[model samples]
Target: MTHAHFAPGRRTFLASMGAAAALLPFAGAGRAEGTSTTRRYVGLYFNGAWDVLLGPDPRDPAQSYDGIDLGTDALAAAYRDPIPVMMAGQEVLWGPTMASLAPHADVLTLFRGVNMNTVAHPAGRAYVNTFIPPSGVVPKGDSMGTRMAAAGAYGDLILPNVSIGMPTFNLVFPPDVTGVRLDRATEMTDLLEPLGDMPLSEATLAALRMAQDEVEGCVHEQYGRPPVEDLQIARDRMRQLLSNGYGESFDLAADADLKARYGITNPGASNDPAVIAATVWRLLETGLSRTITAQLQTGLDTHGPEWATQQPQRQQAGFDALAALLTDLRQDDPNLDDTTVVVFSEFARTPKINGRGGRDHHFAGSVLVFGGGLRRGVCGATLEQTLGLAAIDVATGQPDPAGRVLLPEDIGATLAHAAGLSHDPFRTDPLLDWIA
Candidate 1:
């Protein structure tokens, strides 16, 4: 495989996070109120560099090239021409593979010209996750999902951050906010189940619980109560997980109708894009987590002839799965409005295909955001000549001589702001115009 490599241990979760205090709503500070009232976030990431021209960004073949260079002898081409679609009354070009998403354009918030600033897979992936560049392949700070889990309106949910086959990091948040990592959806169901037969009868369990509560009460009365009372909360949450009906609710095989909708033939083990989409929906619907991140597609680091044939197909399948997930969310009124979804890849492919009939990594990339009361429109642009990122007016997302370049940090800040967080953790202002 001619793919980028990274340190394998980066995916390991922190096992010693101390229990976190009960979550409190983050202050909105003095930021202007946009229309977003969402408290939950869902991230769907493609594991490798993707060819944006076949999805969110494309050039028309029939039109004049003008200053842009198509390379006189390039061998591969997009399987189909770009399709022009009107989004928010503006004509936008959609690549052939993104057809499934055309119908949902009204809610789409496409951010183009995002400068990933690195072609290396590890750096780019880490950049997207935390909006902070890594230090020699080691991720810095907390992942966006972890921050959300710590600051969002988590209420009484036990698992605030659930990451399935996704790279999640936590360097600063409370230990309780650390992600509950799992390889697949089945693991979640298993984790919530009781172990073997009950070792103690109900009477004994009740007596033990009462005894602990009394001991904690006495400690609290003497110590003026631990500020967050987090340890006790953590204990209660663990008991709730073991005793609740969550085992049955999360059993993927129990819902035949849901399996059919997502085209899941093998429920627990499958990693199909559609199956991942369904898993996201299940997590959200059950109100089990405040933030969820999952890898929906992989093997996109195409550096050979397979680029033309395999890349576009994989991209399309992922888009189709996303569209299906949206449709399912629409079935329940207000579901879409309350949840925010983001789709992105580590980076983008080079504009010109290489001699090997494939493309290499590029710095400029695109991201798709929708739901959560966000407006539907494009937020930035790339230069036509080199397909490189262009500076844009942050307030309006338009090209200007004095404009600044867009970065993943801007997106992170925007999302944090929408979640009513007052702090500028990403050290950038949110794209105010992107708000509904």
Candidate 2:
């Protein structure tokens, strides 16, 4: 489905990257009614096509395959090897890089054979995030983060949706729900902190508020337009932000234990995997945002000899950071009890090793959805030899001839359903069996 462009008359203020983290205030008449879920969402995007053989859809190195490269023949590395792990009585092979995450096998669920439908980087990323097959290179729908905000899941949160080094699109969702972009997690402090100390005294502050209210009254009397209303909303929200002392809560570096756990030596200058994950945790723990999408790893598009080395190292580092995030969440505040983390790559690498000793892009993908009330198990699979997608029963997550191939829309719909969105614009239903 396509969303109409933002009307010329509507005034929507988006947060500028590298600038102050300003937010569009909730200008609508409060939030839409009937939001049924309190669960928050975290999206960890592994940019570039990840090699599934080294991640969520690993294959045994000792196995003989007709067309698949187990990476054991010529391209051999400790990280490229797969290790068997049992989850819910099922034996699954996870890349050795998943060692840190394997311990949490009981709380996470794996989805394989996800048909990304596109091998292009931009199109695949857009499709996965927006749940609409891109119209060429453009996204046709709002991101799940924006949709969750529009669904009123964030209530009156000032910064409801946050995108950190991840693409977030908004088509029809309210402008207030647009994801605020940030390069580093510590920038949140910059967004919330006042430019300088409150130079105005209480009397002056009250006077300024009165003057703005008077001007707003005059503007409303002369021009009853949406833009004027939106401006007033922004003003009121900024005032609320300054008065609430929200910036103080986002001082992540001040937390000695958090710094030690995430290895955040300098939060302001660091955008490492640990820092990004820590920022996500802080945002949710402080109730500053409901939905967050962050880029967890990069450089996975290995079509050269480095695939045997760099690919696994990158994947392992990313997984290690994620495992730490989960542990921190569960240990400190039980964030995992009420929060769901969705990890995805645009697509998986080709099954066979190329002439360069690397893998090319493959449309069949895998996903990891865990935390909240999700059951721990594996769903869907790839063909034994070719590594192509296998049709799976959506309910049972098992391969079946009569079942349909899982699409990005199904994942999107499931996220929306879990978030308690009343609408279902996706073409398919959610995987109900995966939910608790």
Candidate 3:
């Protein structure tokens, strides 16, 4: 019923848990790597179902001039004449809002015919992130980000996994391997500089630190040996995070040009997806985190008259942010070749527009991937009449009557492999064709 229901002070709870874990004797054994040369994974989730016909459709002009339209002015205007763009030297029809991504087409790959099975928000979100379909609404295993953080090599990193404005079920991960959630980048600044308002005098600061240390020691004594060591490790980690200058990555005000490029401005009424994307980029670039997950602006559910105006704007904002992020990754990071970015919706919209000029939920959807040596091009197809999924040979990424339909599980498996993680734990097969 409220934002609290979805977020529920998750950031604070995680911070506290990390501090408690520091008190344990073996907590240091789970620390992440101080320096990692391996690749990073970033996930951008577009909440709600996105309309595939609005983006790229395989419909014939004879069957439907403009695929399926809900009759909204916005949809009609945008979808009436879909334009074809060359991506990775292949002709592909792109949605009006996707123009920003055209320049980076050489590295972009689109996957259609993704079967998500469910339209329910909770289940869909969980399934897409974790690759395991929800039994009744709860996730069965760790998400890809959590799994990547759990890898032994990343244990010493300050924050191996970072999630912002996204639904993350970390209970499935090991207690010390959990990710940190922040509602906004500003909150991250606050966490790193909790004493910003306190006295700056050396004596005053020292007294405050001593008081805090005394309290921590008292708590450790009360909790006994195991907890005491974990608490101590957590305290040392917090100090390392502050001293190592990792929090500086969250300072968006330093570079005005960079902020403008990512559409980040001073705080306003709502959080911008561009700023979130930029934050993820900075985290990876600075080695503050190895895996990051963020949600773009919601409201893609276009269930009524709102679809006429709201849906187009929402789609455009998401695409523009993504385009900027990709550009920065290529131009800014020296290790760009080692990073992978994935963007996808839980499912797609219905083929036929409903009476209210809106689309209902559909089982089939699409996904976009770039960087990390993935093959650049389009894969799979959809039928004209029903806009249903078309099976594709997993090995070749080509359409086949008897081929397997691409599913979220396959995407998850592919990502796991890209991160050099074991897919056997998840019991899913990777789409090897996408890997380069």
lDDT of 1: 0.72
Cα lDDT tens digits for candidate 2, 247-350:
76667667888878876677675447777888888777777777888888888889999988878888887888898888866774362656778899889899
Best by TM-score: 2
Worst 10 residues of 3 by lDDT: 1-10
> How high is the lDDT of residue 35 in model 2?
38
Prediction 2 global C-alpha lDDT: 0.72
User: Which residue pairs collide, candidate 2?
Assistant: 21-191
Off by over 4 Å in 2: 1-36, 73-77, 151-153, 196-208, 215-233, 243-253, 265-270, 332-337
Cα lDDT of model 1 by residue, 1-436, tens digit: 1111111121222121223222222232233455343367788888888898888988876765554433323324545677888888999998878988887887788889899889999888888777766776776667777777765545467677888786676654555666777776556666775555658889988997777555433334544554235656655766776787777766668888887777777776556787788878877787777688888888899888888777888888788888888777676644367668889998999887788878899988998987755677888888877787899887777776689888888888787676666436677787777766
lDDT of 3 by residue, 280-350 (tens): 77877776677788886688998786776776678878888888888878875543456677888878888
lDDT: which is higher, 2 or 3?
A: 2
TM-score, predicted candidate 1 vs. hidden true structure: 0.83
Ranking by lDDT: 2, 1, 3
